[model samples]
Target chain A: QQPVQSPQAVILREGEDAVINCSSSKALYSVHWYRQKHGEAPVFLMILLKGGEQKGHDKISASFNEKKQQSSLYLTASQLSYSGTYFCPRRRNLEGSTLGRLYFGRGTQLTVWP
Target chain B: EPEVTQTPSHQVTQMGQEVILRCVPISNHLYFYWYRQILGQKVEFLVSFYNNEISEKSEIFDDQFSVERPDGSNFTLKIRSTKLEDSAMYFCASSRQGYTEAFFGQGTRLTVV
Candidate 1:
């Protein structure tokens, strides 16, 4: 099943901070994050494994909680270029499925102003 | 950096016509996938390919949809008798391994009338 993302949309100003959360009903092995601008392809951000490791780049960071089957993306000091929709594709345990199949969440739309 | 490349960028077709979207995944990658997103909706998985065969597919990938890796470098998704609902942005992605980061292509905007 597809994961669920919270705060369908968010608005932020330059230098502000925000958190986007994703939760899945099924147990997840890993979570992949991506950001998509208007009319563009989804850009890879980071991946969080089930070990509870936190991954980040620049001002964006993400953490995964295996027990809760949830992951969260933190955008620090947001910039105008950060304006986009964030998606979390949760990878479930591949007991009876393909390894590369990722179920994407509905996405969290973030709009950052100058 | 090596990235996935897609052709045409945009395509317009009539209902019941066949449409084929093409992609060139990064060299050395072992996994290829197809996804689509309708305007203002979430991205949906269509299928996954590996080792020149389909590894998994979603329900959205019905009988009307088929995928092929005609050559070592090219992968294609063919839709037979497309319907208006088939209009969406199709994205191709590839990854070095089954459980690694996958890079997405620019995507092909398909419009069916």
Candidate 2:
């Protein structure tokens, strides 16, 4: 199932902060965050694993709550380059070999103006 | 930096025709996947492939759709018969492992008329 993202859109000025949240109805083993500009493929941002393992961009931060099946991305002191849509793709904690696919949320559109 | 590359950045095909989108994932990656997004919609998974075989697929990957890793470096998604609804941006992604973050290609914008 697709995850749910809150605050469908957000507009912020440079140096401002913004928080994007994602929640899944089913058990998730990991949640991946990505950023996509207009007419572009999604770019990998970060990945939050179930047991606290994290990887990806050094500047961006995110947290995953296993018990709640939720994740949130934090963008502090945002820049004009941060203007894009954020998507959270999740992997289910299923015991099958076909666990290669990821289900992405609707995405949160963020616009940062200087 | 290693990155996935997709061909023909954009493709326009007629309804009921065949369309093939090609991708070359990062070297040494073991998992490959195909996803699509209609204009103004969420990205949807179509299929996943590993070890030269399909590992998982979504309902959207119907009989009209097929995937192939024809050579050592190329992966392809073929739509046997395209419909108007098949028009969308098709993205190819790959990961070092199934549990890792996948890198997406630039994507091929498929337009069916």
Candidate 3:
């Protein structure tokens, strides 16, 4: 099933902080985050796998809570480059699965301005 | 430093015509998939292929669509007959491992007229 992302859109000034959340009903082997700008393909950001796993890049970090089937992305002291749409992709635990395909959320649009 | 590559950044076709979107997945990857996203909708999985065969597909993957690994390096999605609704951005993704960290191509924007 497709995961649901909260806060369809957000606008912030540079140095501001924001959070985007994603929740899924099905179990997930991993949660992947991506950023997409207008008229462009999404770019990979980071992946959260193991339960309680926290992955970060610079000031962008995300947490995956396996028990709750949820994940949250935190943006600290946001920059203008952070302006884009954020999407979460998920898959069920690997185990014996083959050719795993990801289901993505509706996406959250975030804009940062100086 | 490897990444997926897609061809014909944009394609325009008429209704009932055939269209084929091409992709070159990352080298050494074992899984490949095709997905579509309307301008304002979420990305929807169409099919996943491995071992040169389809492993799974969603309901949206009707008989009209087919996928192929015709050579050692290319994967393609073909639609037998196009419809206006088929106009969307098609993405090709590959994962080094079957179930983790997928890399996505820039995507091919298909516009059906």
Candidate 4:
């Protein structure tokens, strides 16, 4: 099943902050975050495993709450380069299977202006 | 740094024609995948391949769709009969393992006219 992403679109000025949320109805074993620029492939940002882990890189961070079946991506002091679509893909815990094929959300279009 | 590479960045094919999108995954990666995204839409998984066989495939991967790892370094997705709705950006991705982070290629923009 596809995850639901909040704030279908967001516009922010340089150095501003934004938060994107993703919620899944199924129990997720892992959550992966990616950023895709126009006409480019989706770039891996971070991956959070189950057990309520929080991971960050540079000015971007994410938190996964397995019990709540939700994940939030936080971008701080955003840069112009951060203007792109953010996607949260989830892997469900299927019985007797570990193939880990990701189903992505609708994505949050983020525009960072100078 | 290793990366997945795709060929024919953009392709236009007539409806009902056959088209094959190619990819070369990073050396030593064990898993390969194909995904597609319509314009301004979310990416959707088509199929996953491992050990030269399909491990999983979504409903979108119907009878007309097939994947092949014909050679040691090349992976390909073939659409037997293209349809107008098949126009989309096709991406090839690979991961070191089944549950690891995946790296995607630039993608092939397939336009079925």
Candidate 5:
């Protein structure tokens, strides 16, 4: 099943902050975040595999709450390069096996303006 | 850094014609996948290939669609008879293992008119 992402679209000035949320109906084994620029392929951002795991790189960070079946991505002091669609892809445990197939959310379109 | 490479960044074909999109995944990756994204829509997984066989596929990957790894470095997705709806950006990705992060190709934009 596809996960649901909130704030379908957001516009921000450079150096601002934004939060994108993803929620799933099923238990997720991991949540992977990606950023896709216009006319380009999605780029890997970060992956959260454990509950309460908070991973940060530069000004971007994410949190996964397995108990809530939700994950949130945080972008602080956003840069113009951050303008793109943010996607959260997740996998579920299937009969003790990870399907390895990632179902992606609809995506949050973030536009950072100068 | 190694990256997945796709050919013919853009292709325009008449409806009902055959089309094949190619990809060369990272040399050491063990898992390969194909995904598609219609303009302004979410990316959807089409199929996952491993060990020269399909591990899993979505309903979108019907009989008309087939995948092949004919050589050590080439992976291909062939569409027998294309339809206008098949027009989309197709991306190829590969990962070293099932649960790791996958790297995606720049994507082949297929335009079936």
Candidate 6:
């Protein structure tokens, strides 16, 4: 099933923080995050595996709660460049080859203001 | 720093025409995927290919759509009969192995009239 992303849209001021959550109905092995600017391909951010593992890119971090079948992306001290749509993809059993392809969420749009 | 590359950034075709979108995934990647996003809509997965065969495909990937790995460096998505609804930004992605973090290409914008 497609994961559900919270806050269909958000407006943030520079230097603020925001959290985007992706929740799935089924158990998930990992959560992959990506940010896409207008008319551009989505850029990889980080991947959080099961067991509550967390990963990030510099200040953009994410957390995965395996028990809840959910993941959260945290943007700390948000910059203008952070403005984009965020999506999370879920997959089962991060063990072998199947770990690459992901089932994606609809995505959350974030707009940063000066 | 290798990235997925796609050709013909934008294409226009009339209904019933055939359109082929091309992509070259990262050299070391083993899994290839095709996804599409209509303007103002969410990205949807079309199919995933590995070992010269499809590993998985979504319902949206129907008889009208086909994929091929013509050579060592190229993967292609062919739409046999174009419909207005087929207009979208088609993205190609690849991962080092199956079920891993995917890297996407710039995308080919296909406009079917």
* Chain B TM-score for the candidates in order: 0.99, 0.99, 0.98, 0.99, 0.99, 0.98
Candidate 4 segments whose C-alpha is farther than 4 A from its true place: A93-98
Global lDDT of each candidate: 0.90, 0.89, 0.90, 0.91, 0.91, 0.89
Docking class of 3: medium
Model 2 chain A lowest lDDT segment of ten: A51-60
The sequence of per-residue lDDT tens digits that candidate 4 reaches over residues B5-103 is: 999899999999999999999999988999999998889999999888899999999999999999999999999999999999999999887887889
Question: Listing every candidate in turn, what is its Cα RMSD in Å to the true structure after a full C-alpha superposition?
Answer: 1.7, 1.9, 1.4, 1.7, 1.6, 1.4
Which candidate wins on DockQ?
3
Candidate 4 residue lDDT tens string, A1-114: 878998999999999999999998987777889999988999999988764899998999999998989999999999999999998887653433447577887799999999
Per-residue lDDT value at A104 in model 6: 68
What would you estimate as the lDDT of candidate 1? Answer: 0.90
lDDT of 6 by residue, B10-69 (tens): 999999999999999999998999999999888888999988999889899999999999
lDDT of 5 by residue, A1-100 (tens): 8789999999999999999999999887788899999989999999898889999999999999989989999999999999999999876534334346
Candidate 2 wrong stretches, greater than 4 Å: A51-58, A93-98
* lDDT-superior candidate, 4 or 6: 4
After superposition, candidate 6 runs with Cα above 4 Å error: A97-100
Model 1 residue B5 lDDT score: 100
lDDT of 6 by residue, A43-73 (tens): 9888776667988777899898988888899
Q: Give each candidate's fraction of reference contacts reproduced.
A: 0.61, 0.66, 0.69, 0.59, 0.54, 0.63
Q: What is the TM-score of chain A in candidate 1?
A: 0.91
> Candidate 2's residue-wise lDDT over A6-114, tens digit each?
8899999999989999988987788889999999999999888774554435456888887888888888889899999999977753443446788887799999998
Over A7-79, each residue of candidate 1 has an lDDT whose tens digit, in order, gives: 9999998999999999889878888899999999999999876658898889999999989989899999999
True contacts kept of 2: 0.66
TM-score for candidate 1, please give it.
Answer: 0.94
Better of 2 and 3 by lDDT: 3
Cα-lDDT of candidate 5? 0.91
